[model samples]
Target: MNQSHTYDDVPYPDLCYAYTHPGRIAAIATLLGMQPTPVENCRVLELGCAGGGNLIPMAYGLPNSTFTGIDNSARQIEMAQQKATALGLDNITLQTMDIMEVAPDFGEFDYIIVHGIYAWVPPAVQDQLLAICQQNLAPQGVAYISYNTLPGWHMVLMVREMMQYHTRKVTDPRQRADLARTLINDLVQMIPESENSAYAAFLHTYADMRFDKLGGHTDWEDSALLHDELSEYNTPLYFHQFIEHAAQHGLQYLAEADFTQVMMHDLPENTQLRLQEMAHDTIELEQYLDFVRHQTFRRTLLCHESVDVDRTLRAERIRHLYISSRAVLLADNDGNEYFRTHDGSTFPAEHPLTTAALRYLSQISPRAVRFEPLLKQACARLNLAQPTPEDAHMLAINLLQAFTYSLQMAEMMTCSPDFTIEISERPLASPLARLQVQIAPLISNLRHEQVELDGLSRAVTPFLDGQHTLPMLVDELADMVAAGQLAPSKEHATPEQIRKQLDHDIRYALRWLSRAALLIG
Candidate 1:
């Protein structure tokens, strides 16, 4: 059977910022008490992995883990193959295949990821997806599926429906998107400020949300609009509806990708009590909470029904994981009881030991520390006596819970990336990042964070083979500028002037790369 591939036109090749990493997925599964397959040497599969933007980073980071990505778009698969080849990664395979055509003979995988595909595909394909999850998942494997959820999506659906109607006759994705945007903006402009209709309110709210994304830069978001809003199919389900769908295939909800998303205490007291009273099971409780929060999207994890998922929060899990934090200490009248992050999330340090521990973690941020050593150091800093076995256990549990609850303040990981904080002489760049520069300026960092390199930075990254110093880099740039391969900031500049500018530019690019965590050393 032939399937129409829409992604070949407007490729959905964006990186899912970090949470999809097998390391993070396996860690969450471990916390739930399911003995998940180790990420180091696991068999991983990704469905609808357009151009390998998300899965390639995991493949690069975990070189021993074998990866297979299947996308319907041949163009996307070709791009992914080129990137893998350029990086000299032998552990990954990219194939252009439809999800419905996936066979059991393809073999089982430890981690199966289906992001941005569940709700957008046809209903028959959705069933086939779950069947694949049931048939191909290892005994203790995990499946991550992200989808558009309902209630909150009610408004989004209205907008998407309008966009689809407006672009009904347009075949070209880009032109359809442009027409839809113009129509929507025109409708909004026609509405008077004095008009207090629900339609007017919805238009303004949606407009604000769209334009405000990408830091109020609308140029890059048009593709997203084309793909999501004007795509052929988009069907969002209620939380319980999705759970029911999973149960049909012998898969049960393990937990959310982010622990804090499932935390009901974050809601208002009255709302929480009301939701608890109305719900009989965890799934129902989550569904009701989604209604309260108006959740439009969810990244949910699933495991076989036979696997026991421990819903209880266990502190013992923290001891085996590595910890890192970007939270910084703030001065206070009562001796710095608060730790804050760049995103403005604040964690109040109520306990003496917890307070001291976070300060230490903040100082050594982006570098992970084990629980035992971190605890010992924090206790020593506080001039506290050695904790009893019980006390030590309790402290570890509390810290882990706090970190999970406040992820913006701290992070815990099941695996660590091979990266360095020190900028060595003639520093070497991340080999994966250097390869990515050949394909696109947007590259994945060692931390799996997507970073967009500027023109100068992009040009310099390929030459950062740990063999070039500042002078050598300038010489190469001078030649390129003289040959017109590289554009000068000021046209008609002399080679000497260009060399001088290249010196400053190369240094700036290296510093930026270091800050972006793309430098290996």
Candidate 2:
């Protein structure tokens, strides 16, 4: 099949990727002491934006930020156009165009995103993609590109070869996916685990990761298999090699899209010291880290070569940014309290002020709190008259240290605490989210985080239009139970008990929606 028609035959998965959000890209840029285009009023472009899953949510969130997307597959572009129209998004434009034919005079963008396209295209197209980024990017702009990386890709390529061999005679995309999945499962069962057999270990690991992704997304499985795993033009390169190509196009490495993966803070101190001594520069250190971690994939951020990127990150820089935390307060076996994130990273909360700030962020998490106000509140808790720069510096150091361990907390340039957290009499979710759940379980909330809906949440999503009060929502749940659409916990429950259970259930479901970034205001 032709590369352009690959998506036309079997569509690629249409879902928001959290890391590719311009909020995140800009935040990373700002942290490096580069002033990125504020996500709110910037020009954004996406190369190979399939169905606008990534761009549409961004357009929804940042109405002032103009968006343009191009995909070689007309079918995918049409899907994007249809959805963009349906959403009433006037700020975005979708076009069906090839990367090679892109004109330098076409325009400049503050942020350019090339996700899930780099490694799958032919080499000429790949070079053109990078060249376009350099040509079209605005001053101080950031570009995100994801690819299959080397040393790690060594093993993944083996599995890909095996799958391709199995499906060699297959022409239909759907049949190719079926064959690939079946082959992997068969190999999993056929391979025996042993200490010496590394292939068996890698195979089992691959199966587990693949199945984990395949769990609830049959659409994703087929799309990914055909376009990603079984594609003809998949290419993998080392980190340094990719940078060398980018350099020729006047683009340089900015950072990794994932904050946690870029740092060596998680490694043992001696190992970190040793690696630092052995490697010549930041790029070499990264290559060594990739080899050590056995990473199979990467989402790299790039910028114009003329831009100055400060590698030395200072704690004081976060004082002017927004802060959010999902840290859970827990106690140790000795009853000593500490903060832990969803990723299971524990950090000490030593200072009373820092502890207060963290607690506030945790209470209203996913809602970004301003640094100054947070510091004032923390000082107020300590009964201090006013917050000082000293207070900010202290807190920034603590938060920065914790953020390095894991992304339990984050610093962003664009998020605001504008939305109300309390469950109002009439709750409302974005029209986009409400529209999405009716079509599929996967939807992007206002924060651009992808949410997989549970049955109860899915039922409650459409009703969150500020039209239904809390009691009215409870009534809907009761109606669902009565109509047999929703199952009761106990078959023989009385009417009074069921009503009470539903009243509680509706509250819990809606509250979950609020926290999941699904409920807008």
Candidate 3:
């Protein structure tokens, strides 16, 4: 394979941000109710860890854990290493080695993450990846594997096919993207605008989309169209097929990362009812439905151990409240002036009754206040001094925007002194959720290791502060060993030998700490 073709050629930084944020991972872990053992002690390995964009953030976030990132591209590995060194992060190690070369020696890991690798690679490599996960995943380990799915991609594939035919002679990436866009645009213009013409409507909508200013990157279109149109193994498997394949490898589908996308909720009532009646097992039913939907793009999590995933409790009835800053008008009678919400999204100015509520909230804090107190405060600030039944209803609607933005308090009544807001926790039934569960065991085990290693690393840090020589540290360790604080090692150890030992011990300690999330490098 060409060196460039071996890895994702584009600098997909945004994709990295979207796929691997620590907050999302933490949220998923919390929803699963799985205790992370510690950050300083876990062992994490990432396959296709391109340029360390994803792994570096993780390593930095969880300093106590040990991270190992592998890539076949030497240039990417070198970039990852440079970033690690610049950041002074010692917990992560990057190697320019193929998966096949290191699979055996890699040993079992607590967490194995492979993003944007499975579907893009050849069958042999894909099989090798699965085999590695099967062989080296610890008993409680979870593997996060993302791949392109089907059904959703069917239309996208059609677009790709069209683009490929039009751009067959174009070799340059930018030119190919432009040519594809032009072809799509031309197709759109050919549709006639007429009532009761569904094809015409489709063409018009497609044309509008082609010219839409917000319609994302041209390069993205080129890359996706090229891959979808040309790739030999761009086959999409049903959920059942994927599950069966995983079963053969000693792994079980735990859950999805995004709970909302699970087909159970969105399927037609009749279809759902029929599926429930026909399918015998939970896995079977899910797989059957997935086939029905022709799911494209799977963010599946596989685990070595079976976990019961029914911890999510639904919010039966939520009463929301909101508080916002008073609108600042440029003129006394300005009709268009409004205040921005906490999320930087705008909110239009309301009537005097609503304006009064906002003004009182603004006086207290420019940032929006909670709903419960805002009503009473509005009453006091407006000189009504008492909240009416009518006022309460109006306040509820005014608070709708805040509730939608997730800025309201956890409990409906924000008046209580103890009231603290919490992001509504939903069930983890998506690919993201499944990934969290699958990795839960590994995270816990690694966290434990991280804590132990962190203590050791901290103890040694004082020695490396540059006051003492290598011989002095060795003497101190020897004395401590004699005192039963540490284990005895070689007597008459040279400075270089002692330094080597310290470095090795520190690296090992840091590795475990990185796993635990205590330190990120």
Candidate 4:
């Protein structure tokens, strides 16, 4: 029943995002007071690195840093290798290997990443995965592992069981997925709404989520359902259970990859105090919080147990890091003073210095600024004389706390990747993004963001060298359109209409690329 081949047949779109990058991972580790190896020259390993989508961008951004990716699927590995070769990226190596077979001789890495793999493998394999992290990770290394958490998985598991049972006789992966999806669709219609049964509520909630993911798209949904829901093994564990497993392998929890989850400050004071009483240690506290938050997924970072972890966050740590934020200032009549993030999370901007700092950070966003200069600039903007030592200290603490609790408000990183938001003359695009355009139109930007390109945009991408002027780039698009290779939005339009649309698209694409930080110049 060649189950593993299903993944190769319908490959996962393994794109990189900001949360998974080693730079972001190491920065979080640094904030927690673990002196991780600098991301610039770090050695990284990713298990189940499907198609190397996530690791490739990191290699491209940090040319000096080396990366190795291991996947069990030969086709996915081959695809990744070909893409790496095309980009002239000498820093990364991709291989076909199973997690159970990873050896100590693979050498140590400053950062190890295992995502979308741990909770889906068999128990023995899960143990081996942790062992590999413990043995192959550098003494001060941080490893990022994401898993299906308990309480949240409790609901998902029930739905998954129903899915598997409904399609038990189906052999074809796609058919099975289609049948399971159909089953869920039918159940949603047939099930009675009961306020008492958690199961009924789960079905309603899950149906909405399924529809949201499908987005009326069948092809992509079938593949996702096939791999994620119908995979042969999908085990989940409580937070404490996972911690215990890592402890057995001499690994300790450092922090979550997403910093906001760890910030207990956001919880109501009564809830916080009650939870504190219920939890005797960090592990217990996190497990209880999962119960409270109904957490279904987690991206946890771990380090070797021998290293001392300082859970207490000090404002002084902010000075050692570079900061970036996507927060924007909003108008308020009451002058309550706050900034709102893309996700609607708000941070109080009542403090004069922090508000000035946030405003400045938002202006240069998608680009990181050093902390001291950011603070200095904010102080200058406030029209204040040089901050007294105590004033500076308070500002640092306030800024750090605000950024930590409100992730959308600001982001701090140990280092920044080399890319710019400014559009350049000649306008060079990211070599990695250009390479990705060959595989799929949805490519990762320099900031580890995904941007989807239309036919015109993709056609213009390959020739986005600094040598090509805007006129030349437009001419290339015009050629592509004329040859029937690139299709505009409106089909059967007159040539004049096509030309007008192409001109608009060319300008929009370049500006989009520049804004996404895909412009290298």
Please, what are the lDDT tens digits per residue for candidate 2 over residues 291-374?
A: 999888999999999999998878877766778888877888998888988777777877777888888888888788767888
Instruction: Rank the candidate models, highest TM-score first.
Output: 2, 4, 1, 3
Residue 12 error, candidate 3, Å: 4.3
lDDT of 3 at 38: 34
- Residue range with the least summed lDDT across 10 consecutive positions in model 4: 211-220
Candidate 3 lDDT over residue span 196-244, tens digit each: 5675565456546543422344554444444444443465655666677
TM-score of each: 0.90, 0.95, 0.54, 0.92
Q: Which portions of model 2 miss their true places by more than 4 Å?
A: 1-5, 192-198, 482-484, 492-497
Clashes of each: 0, 0, 56, 0
**Per-residue lDDT over 1-521 for candidate 4, one digit per residue giving the tens place of the 0 to 100 score:** 43433567888765785678887888788877789999889999999998888999889988899999999889999999988998899999999988888889989999999988888888898999999999999999999999889988888888888988888877877788778877887776676665565766778788778745735446556766777667788888899999999999999999998988976776899999999999998888988899999999899999999998988888898887888778888868976667888777787777778888888888877788877898799889988779778878877887787777776677777778678777666878888877778776468887776777766677888888888887777778777778878776798887778778877888888877776777887
Please report the TM-score between candidate 4 and the true structure: 0.92
Q: Can you tell me which runs of candidate 1 are displaced by over 4 Å? A: 1-5, 194-201, 211-220, 332-336, 379-387, 454-456, 471-512
- Candidate 3 ranges with C-alpha deviation above 4 Å: 1-14, 17-41, 191-233, 263-274, 288-294, 305-521
The lDDT, on a scale of 0 to 1, for candidate 3 is 0.53
* 1 versus 3: better TM-score goes to: 1
lDDT of each: 0.81, 0.83, 0.53, 0.82
Cα lDDT tens digits for candidate 1, 427-467: 78988888778765367888887787777888888888899
